[model samples]
Target: MPEPEKSVRRQEEVLRSVNPVLRGWAAYFRYGASKRTFSYLGWYGWWRLLLWIRYRHPHLAWKQLRRRYYGADRITEGGVVLYNPAKMRVQRYTFRGAQISTPYNIDEVDPDGARFRRTNHDDVAFVGQVSEYLA
Candidate 1:
């Protein structure tokens, strides 16, 4: 909740600070059964912003504040757009049945494991010496 005493701050500043957090939260919950949750959160955020506006301008009537801040059912103030989570589409993950294959389920013949074995003893000894020095 924003402090009414801090009403000195501009509406754009508040929106800019809050938009990123709302965007990230909405994105994280978008790929699941979260439509209801998103809608609830959107309503909650809208109500809170309305309360903040009321606190900031106690002299103004509700109609004036609504006209100034809200348009076409969207909240827009000082050219800053409020991120509404309800607008996010929920996409359920579909099972890709039998489309994925694991190493154990592969039917191909295994190739030779030591196809690139080191043939030079000198090179092998140099690597061993380097490893020992590092250890």
Candidate 2:
């Protein structure tokens, strides 16, 4: 596998670890796939699983998904940020030119990881970072 593909797969894995319920729903709904595609499930058991997650862990639902930004000033180009999107916002930190907005009433903020899983999410559009950019 190429380097870019590896990063993409890694991103999917990170997302799954942070939000398994949403990932499973996406997999069943034929949406989130790194290499292979999935189709809708017709089984009652699968529907039951979805319902279980929905009622038990309502925060992980698709509609309630929130994007949490983290600061990674030391991360390299290909690094990826992974965090639970359903977490509440606290302090804010800037990373690699991305601005993280914060609340106004708080003082002495640390901008720690929302759920202890945040990382740097770098943006690279080239197939080969150096080769494509230099060409």
TM-score of each: 0.64, 0.16
Candidates' C-alpha lDDT: 0.75, 0.35
lDDT against true structure, model 1: 0.75
Which residue pairs in candidate 1 collide?
A: none
* Residues 30-56 of candidate 1: C-alpha lDDT, one tens digit per residue: 998999998888888888888888998
lDDT minimum window of 10 residues, candidate 1: 109-118
C-alpha lDDT of residue 64 in model 1: 91
- Badly placed stretches (over 4 Å) of model 2 are 1-42, 63-135
lDDT of 2 by residue, 1-135 (tens): 665653333433533454455445444444223222212222232343345445545667455422221122111123532322222122333352213334541233344523222223453433355467788
Per candidate, the number of residue pairs that clash is: 0, 3
How far in Å is the alpha carbon of 125 misplaced in model 1?
Answer: 33
